[model samples]
Target chain A: MEDLTAVAVHTDVSLWGLFWQAGFIVKLVMVGLLGASIWTWGIILDKSLGFGRAKRAFDRFEQVFWSGQSLEELYRNLGDKRTTGMGAIFIAAMREWKKSFEKGARSPIALQMRIDKAMDVALARESDYLAARLTSLATIGSAGPFIGLFGTVIGIMTSFMGIAGSKSTSLAVVAPGIAEALLATAIGLVAAIPAVIAYNKLSSDAGKLTARMEGFADEFSAILSRQIDEKLPRT
Target chain B: MRGSITSSAIIHAALLGWGLLSFSAPTPMDMANSESMPIDIVSDVSQLQKGDKKAEKNEKPAPKPTQKPQTIPDAQNVGDSETDVETKPATETKAKPVEAAEAPKPSETPVAKPDPQPEPKPEVKPEPKPTPVPATEVKPEPEPKQEVKPDPVAEAINDVKPVPAPAETPKAEPAPQAEKPAEEEFKLPEKVAMPQAKPTPPAQTAKTPDRKETPEKPKTQTASTPSKEKDGIADQVADLLNKQKASAGGAKRSTDQASLGASKTTGGSSLSQSEMDALRGIIEGNWNKPVGAEESPDMKIIVRFRLTQDGQIDGSPEVSGTGADAGLLNAVKSSALRAVMRSAPFNLPQDKYDTWSTVELTFYPGAT
Candidate 1:
């Protein structure tokens, strides 16, 4: 009990005390920044995981797509989720090519033009799908530092004002304030670094996947056109 | 939308984790500040003495000579009644030879006069009849002594002399009158005329002794004031003052001497005021000034600590206005500790055990 009281008494007059008892406003600002940081990191991890899975899925889809399997078979294998995404784009353009050529008015060039337009629209749709929530991730990445900075500014301002009030110049007298300020900055960096890394990774993944989908759409349309030309009279 | 949901969750998680970590770790500054103690007590005693001396000397003019010319026997009475008074005239009438001989009287009265005299030896030169000149001269002698009370040997000498002279003079006067021949006593009714002069000398001496003793009395009154005399309570004050001044001078000299060494130790508590202020500015400037590597001001944190009996800190240190890096702060705390340790068993005057146990230090960076 004596030791505890001694320690408490020691702490009461210390810089640590000043920090613990920092104004309500300062603590609130720090708490708010912390919440923001936690939210940003959660977003970063979620995006990283989701984008990783999508990249893996997209890679697997491409392997099956390159195999000597029928387009209908690939479409059936994709099921619901894949069908509505990048794979759906390939299926849509192929289906369009088959329908256009099956009609009696079948010029290869005319059918190809029709398939190209269909593929362009499908590519647009796939890109739009990938683009969801990217803006929020970007916001988190860019804004993390400033949010942390806001906490730091508040902490520093409070610390210095405390120093002024105490009218002291010793490290012990002033340490808590400085530590709190640095803590805000450190927390800010911690929140921001991963957010930034995660955003960059996701963005690049989206770009790669979008490029591959566009290529697949064009190739699949060509494949469907070849199948239609073969079925028709040799010209 | 699915990716968006996941990404938002990730960002929030990261932000939340950091926030929680920050919240959990409450800085220990308050504890540290409370534990901090005063660093150097010896310096405070020396500093206060300097201030007191400076304040006293700055106000008062330099003390004049404290020894007046000794009183003289009446050559006029000898002339009126003594047959030998005629013999002394030829010596006096030798064209004011006595005044030139008495030219060195002021300097010698203060310096070499060991024996106490009955007659005012310097006053006997009746040729000039300059009684007022001697009186003014004697007052200057006592004034110099009041100034010297801050300096003991000189003050004691002044105190011892004047005190006895005033008391003895009156007793001696009546004896001188009774001892004189009847004819000369008749001619010199002057002794009866100024009967008050004898007792008045002792009274004048007693009043002047207190004036001379004021500087010494204050020292004993306030234990912190410096030296208190054993038998010489008055002398002790002057001795303490001188010792304080000497030690202060010695501290300055030793610090200068220490600065002569290579790689002068910085981050110590003994930095001068301007140096500490300048160091604070440096720390403030360096704080967050660097672009990438999260910079804080390089503070020269001087925690002026008073050491405990067991070598722990006695009291909470006083913190400076500026902030410092973690490494710098630790360095300063340890350096201040080392300084305290180096000055172990501090030479506090035994009487001032409580007061000299603690003092303050303001840290300065690069302040050798």
Candidate 2:
């Protein structure tokens, strides 16, 4: 009669109950996959906020930059603040402009080249920040299923071994071990599906943000080059 | 990053809690969709099977006597052929199955009373027993016993009934009248013993259905049904008559030379499916398919053999039937027989030995 029921408690089928019921190795696998899932979601959240913040900052700065204000005043106003993302690129390029005039302009072409180079470096740093920690999402998405499968294989093997030891083919001997093993796989899938979806979503967002910043740099460099052209004749 | 981690942890914990709360009782599967086949575990076939095999047994033994009568054509002496023809067909027709066998069974029981009324002598009893070679065993026995008891002299000398033909049969014929009387003595005693040994019903059955002539029979029916019973009865009757004549006659020699049938009667309950499956698995395991001939699409091979109690092959398996290319057929047939031989000493239930003792297997060599 005791053997008839495989799992003693109905709670064992629940997520927490299953976690506690799992074998040590299977428990470890489940924990690892869960951690990966949580980490994946965390990265998703941070990236989401970061992309929004960059977009809003770009929107504000673009409004002001396009209003035909003096680039020197804008650069001086940004100098006092610790700026980043798209704003940092504009500041880095403007400082290069100010430096050329203060040092007495050598060549307009050289000034144009230095300002472009400064903006390019700032853009590289911004893109790097946006793309951070995404590779872990891809890793979790791909490896999670395999890890779950390993747990399942081990669980079933253990179940069969129990059956052999008990000398019976009763459902009680079979079902619980198999159920416990399959829970690993279930958790793995749960972890994997989100990681995969979030990785796709967040990476695409990052790509779009980087592309927008690259366009800004290109436009800002052109403006700086034009300002240098105007100053060159006066110098 | 720290805030995001806390938020992600809270979300995962909430999801996990929801999953835990959502666990419901497992519902029973809808049988219409599941469609699982149910099988019963059984130890014996008799428990599951329903039918009387007596009919089959009757047909099987029926052939034994009919073919024997042909050898002792001279044994009756008086219209010897007519008497032989009449008795053999009665049992043979009774062995005909269903309407013919059933109709004659009841008729033969009653008919036994009449055969005795005619001969009313010891000679009559002997002749009746032998003549009912098919259905006549009972008729012959009752008649002979009844006749010999009630009206031996009057029935032998004065009765002109069809059965009285036995006493008169010797007188009317020229060569074998003296021989038949002696033959009846030997055949009757042995035939009587065989029936008596089993049970009254089996005796009545063995003799009545076997005698061929209960009271009277058509010659044609006797000609068709032939088996070991015919050989044994034929030998018994033939040996009696042939010996009395000092063994010089040609037709007598053939009857004299006839051997006693080596047939055995055995019965038990059928084996359960598991036993059959085990037996099949053992055979299939040993069967390494003979190469090059497995592709013969139409090949069919049937092998029949008996097994001993210890699970050893009792005798070499006989290929009872085969249909395929002659060249490929032989390869598969031999391979099947080899498998049967190699898979000896099968571990089977000792109590159910009778059921598994005899087996017939059909092999269709193909992609399977």
Candidate 3:
């Protein structure tokens, strides 16, 4: 009876014990699942913060772009400096307009087309930048559970082998192994659930931001086209 | 991006710290009770000593009283009759000559005479002889009787020479009076003869061909009835001893086996090897591999199921595997399923529900 109690004491079922005593395969599974979970959290954090910053930058750029400031003054304020998201698109439009003026193009239709083309290219680049690393989030979200399940399967297989080797069915003999196995699945879900949720939310947010930028570019081009039409008859 | 990386690192570190803290805390009450091996050994030894002392106290007194009725008559008449005559002047003088002249013939005839007589008569006569011996001397008789009986038997069985010496003494002391029928009333019956026969046969066999002939020669001697009774008693003694030794040896061996089983149980662990063996043994015991199934050592069926705390299956087990003939697979599946069902309500520790609540057993018949 004393020996029995001693055995019970020695076989501590703590989480650390479970991980420490787990077979090599099970330990490997746990480590992989943990890495995946941590990586998923990192992606989630980065995307959420990046999206918030982009929204603020877009708002600030829109205010300045529509502030009734002179076009050359706004262009010079932006200069050739690599600007924020919305500013980049505004700069691209202004550069094309200045080039058209320098070439002595008197046709407003040709001038408007070149300005729109430049802004469209700049808007595409900004959208691409906003959507960066979002695919990895999607991959992590989708693959997280499967990877966790893989770890669980391997851990359970190792546990069963331990049961077979010891020729024991006692819970003490198998509990630690099974607990370790389940931890893998738990970690997998931990990684996957937030990644999946954040992917859905951030991807949609990025889409909305892209549409807003495109809207800003369209309105800016319309404003430029209207000013050109107003001056064309006078010239 | 740098801020997000920093924040994520902080969160990861916090989770890791929480895990470490939980691990570093002392385990719950269930696991804290383990003692060292010396403590266990000390307790076990104390328990064993207590048991041994109790057994000695009980066993020492038991055989003494049971043995007295068997050894008393011969011991008293053969060894104490003369002493009784010398010590007690009144009753001894009155009973002495009659007892002395009567004792030899009766002792001589008891073996041969008793069996032919009704069995009931021999049993009644031995009880009276012990009642007549002075109480003081008879008290010491049992200890010596115990000491003497085994030595002669062990010597007879071992050396083969001491057999004749012991047998000759009894026959020679009563030889002249062996032919007399004057003491028929005082004759010892087959009851006394049967008990005496138990200890003497191994020695009797080594004495003479006459002893062998005595069993066969009893019928011829019966024509001279007195001698016939003598020969028959010798034959019964030899027969009884052989029978007793065979049975005694058998009893000893079975007791040895029982002690072996007790030792196996004594060393049992808390969640004992026997308990685990019982869990698996019950499941494996119920498994019946299908006849004509393809034999593969690696053939396995993995079964997963949840169990309630009391060990009842919470749901049907999920059986998965597909590597054998259809008939074989079905057989293996059903057999494994039956084993799982039959061995349920398992005797497991209720405290450790986290371990057994979900179980996945992989059955590999070839491994067993």
lDDT of each: 0.51, 0.65, 0.61
TM-score of each: 0.41, 0.46, 0.43
For residues B185-278, write the lDDT of model 3, one tens digit per residue.
2332222243342333222322222222222233334445756565566556544432221112211121211121222222222334454556
Ranking by lDDT: 2, 3, 1
Q: Ranking by TM-score, best first?
A: 2, 3, 1
Reference contacts preserved by each model: 0.18, 0.59, 0.38
> Which candidate comes out best when scored by DockQ?
2
Per-candidate TM-score, chain A: 0.72, 0.90, 0.87
**Overall local distance difference test of candidate 1:** 0.51
iRMS of each prediction: 7.2, 2.2, 2.9
Off by over 4 Å in 3: A1-11, A232-235, B23-368
- Between candidates 2 and 3, the one scoring higher on DockQ is 2
**Runs off by more than 4 Å, candidate 2:** A1-12, A233-235, B24-368
How would you encode candidate 3's per-residue C-alpha lDDT over A1-235 as one tens digit per residue? 7744554466566556566666677677678767766777777788787889888988887788677778899889888677867888988888898888777777889889989999999999999988888888888788878887887788888888888999998987777778778877887788888888988998899999999999989889889899788866555
- The sequence of per-residue lDDT tens digits that candidate 1 reaches over residues B129-211 is 42223333343344444445445555446535553544556566453442232224233333333544543343334334334
Cα lDDT tens digits, model 2, B38-120, are: 11112223222222343343312222122333444444223312223334444433333333323444445445545544543
Cα-lDDT of candidate 2: 0.65
Better of 2 and 3 by TM-score: 2
